[model samples]
Target: MDLDPRTGNWRGIHSAPRDGSLIWVMDPNCGAFVMRWDDEETNPMFSDATGMWVASDGSMTWCEDTDAGPTWWKPCAQ
Candidate 1:
């Protein structure tokens, strides 16, 4: 995996936006690309089984829901 030049986050084969509001992250355990909010605190509705987040451009992504909070994110397929 390589860091996205635009956002400095991991990039996957499928391309997505990295405009600073959200970023792509690679799951160390599965090697899958997930999306996470650049600032988790801004997300007031974060919770288990409901980790879906939308970017400024209306692009949506999901993250794993866990007791530790939203963990691994799975980017929506293009």
Candidate 2:
């Protein structure tokens, strides 16, 4: 398990996929995040607030209950 970059807590994991991407496994507390880590930095897989997903692509997704979903998200200036 690796430390969540957002919370500095060692309660997350990063799995290398067969597609060469990444799958971040956060803890149960939903207080941290993990993203596709290639270099030394691990991108926090959070759009605005607490949430849970075995994957991430910058879209609103539901992995489990609604109460544990993201509480904040803003449209990127794209």
Candidate 3:
């Protein structure tokens, strides 16, 4: 909220992500329960995507091909 003391003006305000602020990179091939060893960040959560590339920041992204096109998804809700 913003207000002008001298002129008695006021305005209400709110802000949110235009395209959503959350992005979760989940390996598409992982099932509900699986365990694997990773060479990147220690103790990093791993999924079974058949193939995955984890950057130094521990962010993971993968891609798969389909008849229509490439589909992408973030596994995490937040």
Query: How many residue pairs in model 3 have overlapping backbones?
Result: 3
Question: Which 10-residue window in model 1 sums to the lowest lDDT?
Answer: 66-75
What would the TM-scores of all predictions be? 0.27, 0.23, 0.18
RMSD of 1: 9.1
Error of 3 at 27 (Å): 18
lDDT of 1 at 64: 40
**Candidate 1: where is the Cα deviation over 4 Å?**
2-20, 32-48, 53-61, 67-78
CA error at residue 30 for candidate 1, angstroms: 2.4
1 or 2, which is superior by TM-score? Answer: 1
Residue-by-residue lDDT tens digits, candidate 2, 1-78: 323445433322322232324444344456433333222222255334333343345443333324563222211123
Put down candidate 1 lDDT per residue, 1-78, tens digits, no spaces.
433334534444234443443454444544444444442423344543433434435454434443333333334445
Model 3 Cα shift for residue 68 (angstroms): 12
lDDT of 2 at 58: 45
lDDT (Cα, tens digit) per residue for candidate 3, span 12-78: 1112111323333222234111112133323223343333333324444322222221222322323
User: What's the true lDDT of residue 38 in model 3?
Assistant: 32
Query: So what's the TM-score on candidate 1?
Result: 0.27
